[model samples]
Target: MATVDRVEIEQAQKLWQPQPGWLNTASYGLPPEPAWTAVQDALADWRVGRTSWEGWGEATERSRAAFANLVGVPVADVATGAVVSQLLAPVAAALPPGATVVAPEVEFTSNLFPWLVQAERGVRVRTVPLAKLVDAIDAGTDLVAFSLVQSADGAVAPYDEIVAAARAHGALVAVDATQACGWLPFDAARADVVVVGAYKWLMAPRGTAFAYLAPDLRDRLRPDAAGWYAGEDPHASYYGPPLRLAADARRFDISPAWFSWVGTAPALDLLAEIGVPAVHEHNVALANRFLAGLGRPPGDSAIVAVEVPGARERLERAGVRAAVRAGRVRASFHVYSTSDDVDLALNALTG
Candidate 1:
């Protein structure tokens, strides 16, 4: 059962400086006041010439636990990273040379480029349309890379079906859930590797992200880029001469941004307290409202995309916040967004 309700979520929205009909969370999320409070407390400790290793470490671990909970996985499966690119570099490198990677061409370029770049170095990268993605995977394919939700058009991918097919062929699956993590419920345990950029939907600051690697997959891949922090006892890494890495997913973690970790604790706590199912329900309702206002069938996604010419200018003049992607205006919803916010965006488009 959810401990927090719509009233509590609406109250939490007050912490963020109210936007002028903001609906653009898909591009970037608004920071809550609690996140700032956490950052300020950490900075104050830093100013006193006192480093709270315990406090800092606890914050980092708490973030890992929180993300694990969000993805329905154990904390041992989660690895922290400075950003998606840094985390994905190891994942991309882990693939056997000459492996075939299947991906959608229209996905967020971060999810696309890493796999595509492998083409230059003996790997086969096949870019296909989203509808054709499942058919592209077969016995010859070694990896399948894709976003959980299409960023440009807000289309949800057939993830479970794709994962099942990929697994049947001995292909590893990598998912970028940055766009879908907080607003939609997914079984993270299904993917071999799940990466999330926390700043967007997870409601954390920039410079924070995480990757979840299956226990078996961790041992199978070569730890070529494992840094000093990858070890079980990161502090003892310098004191001892042994270059031992963690037995679990921690081996993939890079040096994390401490401040972002501090902020992440509270942000994730808020969502967990509210419950993802509740948040998903709220955002879906708003998305449906927005679609209905436009007289379109609901796509059952938090993002409501419409093709509008001069979208940027029109939204700007109307004080409506949205993202322009692939010539479409994308207005995304969060638990904080209300029916009014959807109506405001709809009116801006039609009026």
Candidate 2:
């Protein structure tokens, strides 16, 4: 009896095969070996016209059920999409005109763009200051959308607190958790709506994302955008009369690429098998190692500030491909990032 649950961990590690010099997992890494091979095997069957989406579809359903179980939610509430944008577009479309959306400065474009466009239409877009973002929500704030962990600075905001504050003011909370998955423990129990990208921390490919819709708010949310796939009847091709959408978050989903769904199903299955808590612990151990490697000096050191003199140039010269934002350089971490990757990144930063 392996009390540590190393059974799934071993299977996942063998399944998600990584390439050489692959420190860029935060960019996009393969899913664990077992799941990757399983997905590919399933895809091969689909491509050869041997097996249909039935097994994959059933697997997809099981994956979501497992995901919901991992997040402490009901199976019926989760929905899959080709990307987080598709799942969130419904929430964006359903927003009242001119409503204010509060977001942090460190968030990704996927979380910001959907709400920012509303500014031109009378929706007040407020970028909350880094320190006060948690306490900034008020009665007038229509919604507060942000990333659980900042992709730019690696600074994780107080997500639970932000949700509580925004909800107290009657504002909806939307979390873009692309960087948080596999790295952080995500319990969607308190979040009104949260989207996760499978490519990054989740160890899946691009165009595969999932959304968790808080059960209580499902009815209140209207799908401003809908398609045949979004309807309750997937086989409903008559198109004669208006078909009612799914009762759950599935109504928010649009054209889901079944292939991508097939790919994600096993990828997530690997995670579910390894267990979210264990994966998160492994990732945090890596994050702590890399953060400790960045030995930038204090005071005038703009290591974290919006602007830093020669820091970006120096890092580039040292072989670190850095993304410059607000005059700062940031490197992200994911599960496959081992101590060697951390040391290499640190060596580059220092040299």
Candidate 3:
């Protein structure tokens, strides 16, 4: 649990050059210089046919290992994919007939739809208020799924309580870390399945995602989207034959989008170097500063939902970038965000 010092945070901050008014990281992140450069280099190679596909594929492994390290999991337990829903598909498919899942009522559709779609097979999904999520898990609950941080409002889940409840009920735990990963320090290994769509918080390209499947959970899931990429040896697995897949979570991998991985590798590597605890401290401080300016109490989350009248249009007019979610102005802070960014948003809304 090494924490990064100010020097390290300053060094990491130099890697990105986000515009001063940028506050919409919850929607998408601006890539760090290394990641942007890596993607550009890979795209150049693709344009000229200067390198073989094998070279591009190497980035996928790099990204997978980096994501595993970021989440405190072994690489063997990690699976790579292009989106959160795609990665969760097999987990959803693994549900037993008549199984029940408990989730937050406002969960992003990517996590909710997969389980809800199982209704035709007798699997039931129960959605409750975020505050009631832990208490709602019962003996009949087969699994509990939720996001580490809510996308619309930046509410952090009660991770320990939910996990304890799930364990008490002999229920499996699944978490989507899309909005929390790089800025929130938590043990992803505590969950049976952890999925991340890296584009938003990890500052990577949109096509990059990762999942960690605990060994027992991995055993239960079928690699429904397994392709040559999921093979024990991808190059050798091309063309039909007696099926051979990796013995680990890689068996769930989908064929990666090459340029996306090229960018993802460097971005994740940078985040790992800076340490999530450092990022969390920096981001939450900025968020609190903004909240204070707006005459609101400090919050634990880096994303703030400002409900002031005409907030979104004010931010837009002031050249501040933020999202409108659930009728509030959603402004998120990340490692690249500065106090200036927060001030800009505050001025827009308070002026």
Candidate 4:
């Protein structure tokens, strides 16, 4: 039996409702009111010249610590990247000069491009079927990178099998956990690197995210494209004399996005209030309602393929703003989304 948890769920949905034609989470990621309130304060603080390198330095440390706490890891092992792109930097740098980076066939470029461009060092990138990923990480592959929940299908990958396979082949695993961050609970023990971009479910603004490098794997990464902050003595060192990189994952922290720190905190505070599991259940329930409303797909299709044209049109005709990608209608159901909101989306889709 599904527990009815419309209390905070309704608040989140009502606060972040989408207008017509608002389909993609990509184009219009709706954050809660509290998130906006936080960002507004951060922006005001920024305008007043309250944030500085050191101030942000402390903020970065705090954000990283918060992220580490969320992922169940020690703060010392966490790295703060202003954006998710740099989050992949350490993983790319850690690979051998000439290595194969294997990824699932369909992926957000966040997980694909960094490795694809690795040809400079003779690093080969291979696109494999998602179903075969567990069997595909043979001795030839150096690192296997992909998202835990693929963006296209909204299908959560079997993390345990993927990790076991990579470990069995002695390969490092880099998970683009942007989609799974709030949708599910993640175990850091299963992955060497778990990079989560905060914009989507964490309800943070763009340019805000964190990358968790497994404590044991922290020492193995070579900080490529590092800066002053990468060093332990960055504060006192001059002329970049024999630049020393940070011994911990803090080496990855270049600087900070002052505004995101401000805008992101309120929602984070709310997340702390509602709790992760409850939020996850809320999302799951909405997805279930939408999926159930889809009823039975055509004999062959399990869910609507996003690539199919008019998915947005069809959902719109039914009365809800929706995105059809891969093969599922990707809908956002937050703490604010009520049974009515779920019913609205489902009714619009199934009608």
TM-scores for all candidates: the values are 0.93, 0.83, 0.97, 0.84
Model 1: per-residue lDDT, tens digit, 1-351? 334567777776787775667887888776777887989888898889577656766677888999999899989999998677666777787777888899888878888677767766788888899889998999999989899988887888899889988988999999999999998999999998999999888888888898998888877766665777788878777566677888888888776678888898888888887778888888888888888887888887998788777777777788887887666888899977888888887787777
The models' CA-based lDDT, in order, is 0.83, 0.67, 0.91, 0.69
Tell me, by lDDT, which candidate is best: 3
287, model 1: CA deviation in Å? Answer: 1.5
Put the candidates in TM-score order, highest first.
Answer: 3, 1, 4, 2
- RMSD of each candidate relative to the true structure: 2.1, 4.4, 1.6, 3.8
> What TM-score does model 1 achieve against the real structure?
0.93
Task: Return the TM-score for candidate 2, rounded to 2 decimals.
Answer: 0.83
Q: Write the per-residue lDDT of candidate 4 for residues 72-91, one digit (tens) a residue.
A: 88887777776666789767
lDDT of 3: 0.91
**Residue 170 error for model 2, in Å?**
2.0
Error of 3 at 149 (Å): 0.4
Q: After superposition, how far is residue 203 of candidate 4 from its true place, in Å?
A: 0.6
lDDT of 4: 0.69
Off by over 4 Å in 3: 1-4
lDDT of 2 by residue, 195-222 (tens): 8877777666577778898877667777
lDDT of 1: 0.83
